[model samples]
Target: MGRFNFFVAFIFGFGLYFYFDQSCYSYFHKEASSITKSTASGHILAYLITLIPLLITVLFLKKKEINVLEAVGLSGSLTKGFGFAFLCTLPLLVAFSVKFSLNTGLSLNTIIINTISSAFFEEIIYRAFLFGILYRCTRLGFLPSVFLGSLLFGVAHLYQATDFVEILEVFAITFLGSVFFCWIYAEWNFNLWTAIFLHCLMNLYWLIFNVDDSAIGGMYANIFRFLSFFIAIGITIFYKRRNKISLEVTKTTFCIKPKDR
Candidate 1:
């Protein structure tokens, strides 16, 4: 019974943060007919409004031990965790920025607000909440947790596309990106702060690059994506080696198991 309640809360929590937030925000925005498009203030307001229910749900959960700030991966030392995470992600962001050309006309206020809000909310739901639940509550291993979390993350982006090919493209890109995000979280010992910074930089890069426009051709896109993927894989391998943690996935669960140093 207790486990059943926990499962229900977990599902509800995901729905509240992941599924409902954007839907509610869109509905209210349309009904009010005040904001024609997403402004900085509007984005902030929507995020805050949606955040309320998630926070409430967290409060009601049986395991209050899940420290959100830490789950967001901010718990580690600033120098080691935050700085390292930022520098590690910097190259990819820089490359993307150069490739896409910055949109100077885009408001800095909007960029900053959206980056923080998005990093906070998305990481909270995907990494901190969903992945955390699987990591902590279930017998699943790290890899499996990441795969499932990333899978859901990919699915959540489907609404952005109507075409089948575009949908597949979006899912593939997002799923790979989520895997990278999960790797960061794991590399930092499941600290969400590490993942959050990476996520923020990625979002900022996309925003600046004008994601609506495909600035590069297929060959270039594939090259860039593969390069980024390799970088993530390399980093994960290095982190595990340096920490003396084994990346042995269990056969039964196909989960990531990090043997401690």
Candidate 2:
């Protein structure tokens, strides 16, 4: 019953946020820009509206006697999350630095709106709320828990591409990226900051350098990105082995765990 309530609440809250964010964001941004006389402020105000769904989820959690911070994976060690993410994404930083020149025109507004806000808010909504509650609270398996959120995450990036082929590529990449983020989130003891920092640093590096206009980059760009992927996986495996911690996502739990049910 608790899991059912949580699932319904999150879906409803996220649905509401998604609708408003998609349909009304421009209006809110325009209104906010008129008041603050700053486009960045407008963007910030629009992004802050994401908190409505977060607060809604928190209310449901409170009713269930769950600690909101821990449940949402916010109580984890920020230092560890940021540190590991930085180490794992070193390849992207180095590769982009060598291959692409610095984007001199990059502004603070771009960093705040594109990298920081997108990373933080998307992770909280998609990974923590959508995937986390489904998997942890409901005991749904990894594949099932991550599928819907990842699908939406992928679809959300379709705006970057016009043609069908490019759209497919963008969707595939972002969908896999979503799954990877969710995997690390679970592996790191459900600490969402890990995913958040990783997403932010990667996006920041991409934005800082003139890598590619869209998420789908050239062959060289993707090469380094894949290297970073392998590095993250390798490091995670090593860490788990050294600490004797079993992986959270395993074959036995790939689908609904009969025992857990």
Candidate 3:
């Protein structure tokens, strides 16, 4: 629940700042170059909104009052978080098959924008906030959490899309891709950094491939849509099984000697 609290609060802050303060949207409205001076102010201003929430989350984790580190983790847990991110890179490696056109593929500046800023915003909001929150109270089980989290993650992208159909397709792709990322978080008992890196790579891969927008899901698209689903599910099931085994093993080691009531 602490994870959820941190996430929800951050979102509340971001929403208030974005809508009322008019950060990025304001830049666009004014036709300002966000990559440049005046627009940079908006970006900084936007991130500032979540300052409190991010700080609170770190403090809460630092206090050792919750199992957040165990439930999900930080960058410090290299083996669990970083390793998992590396492993998950495989599916994406295969999926992003589109040949890069030197002229067409992403520029270095775009990489920085996409990988650093955009990725940070997306992960902090969807994975950290949505999954971290809902997983706390509802024991409705794992798949359900993945499904719901993915749905929320996808739906949020609607704000950026133009039409209904495109938005829906984006949602579906996001949901599927998100489930795999979420599986890592849950599987390793909540490794947040792994989720973050995997997410960044997922987006980076798509951008590098210069994937046709329509191929995300449309007639004659190159995407092996059905295959990706199966692969994601297969990985998820394997991890879930492995996690259950690890949990059972650890239960014996942490036995309680009852405290004085």
Candidate 4:
């Protein structure tokens, strides 16, 4: 019954978020603009409306005696999360600095809207609410749990693509990115901050430097991106081993959980 409720909650929450995010964002943005003069504030407020489902889910979990923070992967160490993310993404900072010039005209609004709000909200919505609940709270396995959200995440980035080939490239890269974020989120003991900071720092570097116009980067950009990926994965494994902690996502839990089996 608990798992059933969780699954239902996920469906409802995800649907609500999607509807408002896609359809009602403009309306809320206008309403928010009336209240707050800043466009960034309006965007933030509109994004906040999309989190109604998450708020409701947290309340629902409270009724079930679930630790809301732990369930959503928010109870992890913020410091460790930021520190590890910085180390893992250092390659991007270095590579971009060497290959691309910094944007002298970058604005505070861009930082708030693009990097901070984007990373934080997207992680909570797509990852914590959509993927986390299904994988952690319900009986769904890693693959099944991540598929829909990752697909949606990929599809959401299609706006950046101008042509069919670019569309394909964007979708593939974002989908793979969604999967990588999920893996690290689970591996880091469901500490969402790790993924959040990683996402933020990556976006920050990309925005601060003229790396590429789209998520699908050029060959040189991708080479360093892949290097960052390898560094993150390597460090995760090394720390898990050092701490004698079992990895959360393993072959046994890939398709279905042991209890389900």
Give me the overall lDDT of model 4. 0.86
| Candidate 2 wrongly placed segments (more than 4 Å) | 2-7, 34-37, 61-65, 258-261
lDDT computed for candidate 3: 0.53
Task: List clashing residue pairs in candidate 3.
Answer: 4-133, 71-189, 71-190, 72-190, 73-190, 73-191
- Predicted candidate 1 versus true structure: per-residue lDDT over 1-261, tens digit per residue: 275777788677767676667669876544443563545556667666767776666556524566655544556665665566566656666666666666777786678675777776788777766676566555567676777678888997788666888788878877877877776676566667767776776566666765453312255445654565566568767878898996633353355444441
State the displacement of the C-alpha of residue 72, model 3, in Å, after optimal TM-score superposition: 6.7
TM-score: which is higher, 2 or 3?
2
Q: Rank the candidates by TM-score, best first.
A: 4, 2, 1, 3
Per-candidate TM-scores read: 0.74, 0.91, 0.62, 0.93
Whole-structure CA lDDT of model 2: 0.86
- Tens digits of per-residue lDDT, candidate 4, 26-63, equal 99988997898877899899988867766676557433
Look at candidate 1 and give me any clashing residue pairs. Answer: 72-192, 72-193, 73-191, 73-192, 73-193, 74-193, 142-256, 143-256
TM-score of model 4 (CA atoms): 0.93
Q: How would you encode candidate 3's per-residue C-alpha lDDT over 1-261 as one tens digit per residue? A: 455765565456545543543444454423444545454444545554544454345444332445544423454465565465556565555655544332365566566566656666666555654555445433334554456557867776666567887777777777766776665565555656766776666566656665554325343232444444455446656776876644311222223212331
Candidate 1 residues lying further than 4 Å off, grouped into runs, are: 16-38, 60-68, 78-82, 97-100, 210-218, 246-261
lDDT by candidate, in order shown: 0.65, 0.86, 0.53, 0.86
Per-residue alpha-carbon lDDT of model 2 for 73-102, expressed as tens digits?
888999999999999999899889999999
- Give lDDT: candidate 2, residue 259: 64
Candidate 1 lDDT for residue 254: 56
